[model samples]
Target: MKYKTFALSALALAASSAALAQSSTGSVTLYGVADANVQVLDGASSLTRVQSGGLNGSRFGLRGTEDLGSGLRAFFVLESGINLDNGSNGQNSFWGRQAYVGLATPYGKVSLGRQYGSLYNLSSDFSQFSNNSFGASTAVIGGFGGYEPVRGGDGSAATNGGPTRINNSIKFESQNYSGFSAGALWGAGEVAGDTKGNRVADIYGRYTQGGFDAMLSYVDDKANTVGLKTRTVSGAASYSFGPYKVNGGVISVNDRSIANADGEGYWLGGSYALGQHTFKTQYVESKNKGGLVDGKTQAFGVGYQYDLSKRTALYSSLTQFKNDGNGYVARAASSLPANLTSASDRDVTEFVAGIRHSF
Candidate 1:
């Protein structure tokens, strides 16, 4: 397999910013992705738009590691999202995407800061679409479909599909043993008066051997805003044979109180690579099992990618959202397909052609 990554050194930036300890044993690197696309979004009306991140999100980040002592290292990362279409920041926070520092030992690694929840990390691998705004089920399942920019923000609890990134969190992951490993996280509730305010946590275990991979995950969300409690459990798997690879997963969100609704979603996707070109297809469907929420969203997408080089690629995809059942809008977690139409049951179509470069 051949892939590309773009990374810059931090020595230059460090030279001007701070004095480096002559004895310090560590290094820093800067890296990011630049991706942009043109799309036709057909919502209530037809709209043409230029977008960023079709296959992958664009963002720049700084990461560093320092040798602390015998078999120990201190590490940190500061990452931000980018929107090339408008030249705007991706995440709301300056380093909204990720800002964390941790220690790595022979046995495991532990860190504290804003970080990805267990479920999100687990889903990224098994997911064929990976919650892409356009081609992924994660978009509709977790409300990532542009309708909510802050799906995991404070005050919003248990309403999301996949357990998203967490803020003010502590996490631990055991060193990989063979082809299996485990990890857990605890996001602290920062409210002074309330101990459990905005607190969340998750745990997951994964195994991979040869071309087969699988995972089991659990999420516990306890938000103080409305005292809403959300619990989730999921299982997923994937396999690859020759030029073809297949992936699938099932997720269930248990939130039967406030909204009196429990959400469930399933997705399956497959791809085949022939030389420099790869073809893709996927389907995602989600619904709330109870409460007044009586709508579900189903999406189907197909795309092609042509490798321009090891560092860049040109790609295109066409996706449709069937806002069937009740009155669900055609949307993704990060980007909406077209826009929502006046009729809740209307279908939305999306097509994108784009170029992506990594550095």
Candidate 2:
């Protein structure tokens, strides 16, 4: 799939709707995903708990589209992230995840608002875990601490492939041509006294044919505090044969906030589906190179998923992360509380079982 504005693409909008309304002039859709899991953490602290958003973040959303004649359409989306375990807003905003409107034309589409970064759109399809906070893309490419540039003292408030979403942004996507598509976006920081002090920008392209899929992405973030800038370049690909599928990608980061904040990582994973069951496995490696930051990390995971129906599944996985240097803190990729210790050389391990449903 091509990376495009979520609100501008009818298919992207429909992916989150729980229901659909068909009309001559327009259509409306309501959609969401509910996923939760039982987790066991065994590191510095050992505990078990029930957590939300195992395979996907629980969410509810409404999307609408109206034809405007002459091969044009007006579309909008309002998506809310939710916490099923506590019945609270996932990110403290009613429309914390997405709220955007755009126009679609025969040539391409343009949109503005809060939306996903094009890099994620391109790399996610090639990830074994679909960039879930689980064993694949998110934990590897977009994880926590200094690997990601810190903003407002929060390590998670940074971007590797553009922070998953951008606020106050404008996006454009070209129509697919012979299975190839390209996209770009510019996110204005809206800083009070500084015009370009805090800004975010990215460009991405994708190609698909037969059983092969590939993508390349580039993003620059100057959205953090003064003098902090980070640039990321990433690419991924996937192929399928019979019931087996394989995927992998590499991500490089140049953190200009401080000398030697540069880092890089890569992952390889595969899965085989048989009947209603699928088996999956993956390996990820990260390095803090140059500058002052220095460390190496490795992660491995294995999982199984059993389909109970078209919209629901039972899944379980075991994952572990090992750190080799004092400053390389990330040890695992799981939403479950079970995780690694910040102490250098301490490894984190976890086991999880979950259910996911979508409508």
Candidate 3:
């Protein structure tokens, strides 16, 4: 969305509100997902625990819109992330998931405030696991030490995309023209004296036709640290036929924080749905091409789901992770204890069973 600001006089505002009260239309909706799971981890250490967000994050949100005439609408969203396991803020801030206000025009949408990056939003269309944190999720395989660039120590820039959200940003999204749409976002650095430090820019294009969907994304982030920058390029696609679906994607990264550091990640997966039962499997890999970051990992995952109703389901997944290099230390699961570590050449096995409901 494109961001625009306007100033209104008190008399004008009062007159508009009075007119809106008489003729304007608007609506508000409350929605959320409640998802949790029991997990077992087997590697250098064994542990069992309950976790939040197996298939989806646990959260609640409010969204509303007002008709502003002329095919234009004003809208706002306030979404908060939750940790069901402990009842704590999932993102450490209220409305951490999304908080934005924007205007929707005939041509496109423009929004301002904290929002998601285009790449992050596009991944859902092509992710077999719906971009969740379980199974063979891309989130697990692509951990080249913070592939998702967040605000640095100086704290000037918003985080860049790895399917992660960005703060202090403005976004513009084009209306779908036939089967294609495009979007771009820019986050100002707001540095004290520097114009370029801690800034992020992202852009993406997508297409959908019949049962096929494809997308490409690019991101550039100037970290708060001096002389460091990160860039990412990604492409993904998915197709569906009958009750079956297939998905695959690749991401390449060049992070200058570590000299010569370059890496790539890829995944291919498919799913079949029949009646109330669905089955899926995926293989994912990440490799480092340069620098001392020997981040190489491979994983295979399989899962099953049984829908109990339109808004609830029972699901389970089994995955195995192989760390191929000394510098690659990610494990097989998400939200694990801080001390959990995977040694090079060691395999980490994970099992998860969960339930998810949405409103």
Candidate 4:
């Protein structure tokens, strides 16, 4: 009887040890975001859209990490975009926005799959909208410019492909060093028999210390549709003093295929918080060089938000855009337009008011 009891105890101990080992080795997490809004566009005519992912892109994702031990980890992320309005899949892909597997260690992380470029991440980090919001001017100022035509064969704006995201990418992010971090990404063109010239590369670095922050980025793409290689460089800084934060940045783009096609731009933005109310404003300008015509444009916007609860808020924004030179016009691609000239000339003004909730 004593021998049987001892053997049973030993078996239990072994099982417990195996369970602990498995638990220490890996974990998986499920996370998601949902955002929707009813919006109106004015300018040339009145139009309305029930939009999903207003404040944030709606998405659901699974993320996992396995400890390889010795401070090294194997990780993966598979995220799918979702349309909250109709409870449908966004982009109709299982892992549309982000699908990557990589390794992480004290050195940093190396990931391979569809992902954003380093320049995109750096600019987004410093922008007030961070590539969201109806008032975001990143696309208008040519800061995020690329070769993909805005309109398709039907002359309507194309949705499937654009500059905002990238595919077939391998990226590396360096571990933070003294409050500074850097990253680089390369997108494979995957063209058979030719690999060198048909790709994109981007690099970015940033420093943050105390209440001050700064960033810089550069991107180059040769496979763009116009057969023109494009290069962009941008930098910005921000400071926080008490209840207010002020930030600004400058961006420049060069297009080799289009004559007079170089462009430079700058932005200044700030926000102030007072009790339950926050006020924000920004101004942006861009100038084109050696293009068909010297194009120039400017934009100004202001916004306010009131917190209703920890997870809910009410917000409103007013913005306007002005353009000059031949073929220069501003169009409200994201929100309601404000004036008739903008409607006829492709210029735009917009206002947005909405409520947002998060969990």
Candidate 5:
């Protein structure tokens, strides 16, 4: 009887040790964002359907990391988009937004699978609107033009190269040095031969010190579906002085399929806070040089927000776009139809009021 009791105790100890070992080496986390709003267009005949992520898209995701020791670790992320209004998938894919697995260490991090290109990542930080918010109109205004239809597939803009979220890609991010860091990415065509020319490549770098930050990035693609062969170069900077912050950036796009289709764009934006109220404004412009036509478009926006609490806020914004010469086609307005008549020429405007919460 004494021998049997000792044996059972020893087994229990061994099992507990194994479980603790596993817990120390790996971990998984679940996280997400939920956002919704009511939107109306000025030109529309009547108030239209309501939606979410109007200021920001809704999403959920799973992420995990495993310590491999010696400063090395394995990590993976799977994120999915969701429509909060109907409780349905946003892009109709399990991991349509981002799906990646990679390894990281003190030197830097290298990731594989699907991910955002260096150019998009860099540009997003400078804009007032990001993801699905009011700033999303930038895509149509040529702020960061490329193949944009693959991920959203709304036919509102040209497809940049692959999906905004790339596939079969390898990305490398460098460690910060003196408040500066850099990164590069390459997406494989997965075709038999001719790997270099048929694929995509991007490089970017940024610096941040004190209240000032700036970044530059470039992307090149030889043969992306949609016959999209493009090169984009962009940079942005911002500074905070007192209770106000100022930001600005420029982006240039060169497309192979269209003659003189190269374009350059810039934006100037700022924000100020007084007690519980915050005010913001932005001015953006785009011009096309060698395309079938020559023209320029400009957009102006203003917004105000009142924080009701740490996690909730109410906000309102209004934006307008004006086209000059042949540039009417390049205007960015939420009121414009997803499918515009090629022959029509007109200005655009959008206004939105909503509430946002973060948990």
Candidate 6:
């Protein structure tokens, strides 16, 4: 990825401003994405409006790295999600998107703070749509709810869709050895009396060689107070040949404490790139069991993108969803229109066109 960088120091050169001066060898880069779109939803409720993060989430971030000598480095990232539609905080918190600092060594990297889990990383990397929240996002596909931008503070097992961002956590990621790497993370429950009151543990492994990429991740969330536990496992793979790419993944989640909470979801998709234009399509479905939630949801989506330049692009997508029994999956979960409801299972069709620019 290309980013605009501002050099504040050049070989020990000092600046008049103390904040901008760095005595060590390092660099800080500022980057962000601005994406917005017009969307139309047709279903139990029909509506049209402008939304943010059509192709990608809108956010600004500052990332820096400092060389600590002898194959060691210190790095940090602080990202803030932005809602382009109304200029508000996208993830509620000023730095809800990501906020972490770590030290990188030859063997591996250790970090602490809020960050994404392995499941989210794998989903975004393997999905043709990049798992965006809008359009053909895989967010509504799984029994786990896909990827959630906001995470529970108590490590609640109810959000079992797979942890997107976690707070008060420590993570270790091994450096790539040959074509493989692995990582593990643990989030402290922070409950005074019980250590496992609201704890989270996750692990993942990945391999990348030539045109093939594969990943697997597992997450365990425990809510001791509520006697609820969630376990999730997922795997995904992608292969690229020429200008064509194929990808697929499956996710399974089980929560014995809650009825209708155990479900499985899977998706398959492919894409073709021709010069500056790309076309893609995918099918995703989920099956749930128990009680009124004993239902199934399926969707088909197609999309097109035209890159006008390295930093800007035009894109559009459409997805049609079908609900059987009481399944209530839709295009976007958090940003759903107020008029839309899950009163009864119904079909939904979403159309969106947008522009994205990165800086």
- Write down the RMSD of candidate 6 (Cα, Å): 7.2
lDDT of 1 by residue, 22-110 (tens): 33578889998888889877767777888888777789999999987899999999988888888777655567667899999999999
Residue lDDT tens for model 3, 271-319 = 9999999999998787777776576778799999999999999999999
How high a TM-score does candidate 6 get?
0.86
- Residue-wise C-alpha lDDT for candidate 4, range 1-359, written one tens digit per residue: 99999999999999999989987899999877766767655555556567666556678889999999898999999988777768877645657767889999899999987776654555466666554545644445532323111110110112212134556778899999999999888877666765545566778898999999999888776654435466777788889999999888887777666453677877788889998888888887767766665767677878788888776777777777676777655433243334545434655667767666665
Give the Å error, residue 72, model 1: 0.7
Give the runs in model 3 whose Cα sits over 4 Å from its true position.
Answer: 1-24, 142-163, 225-228, 335-345
> Can you give the TM-score per candidate against the true fold?
0.86, 0.86, 0.87, 0.83, 0.85, 0.86
**What overall lDDT goes with each candidate model?**
0.73, 0.73, 0.76, 0.67, 0.67, 0.75
Two-way lDDT contest, 2 vs 6, winner: 6
Per-candidate RMSD, Å: 8.8, 9.8, 7.5, 4.4, 3.7, 7.2
For model 5 the TM-score comes to 0.85
lDDT of 5 by residue, 1-359 (tens): 99999999999999999999988999989877777767655432334456667555678889999999999999999988777878887655657667889999999999987787764555456666542445324554432223221121122112323424556789999899999999888878666776665577778899999989999877776653545566877788888888898888887777666443677777788889988898888887777766576777677888888888876778777877666665335445343455332345455566777777765
Clashes of each: 7, 9, 7, 10, 10, 1
The best candidate in terms of lDDT = 3
Give lDDT: candidate 2, residue 9: 84
Count: clashes, candidate 6? 1
Global CA lDDT computed for model 1: 0.73
Candidate 2: tens digits of C-alpha lDDT, residues 193-226: 8636677787899899888999998888785554
Of 2 and 5, the candidate ahead on TM-score is 2
Q: For residue 16, what is the lDDT in candidate 1?
A: 47
* Regions of model 4 farther than 4 Å from truth: 1-17, 85-92, 142-164, 224-226, 258-260, 333-345
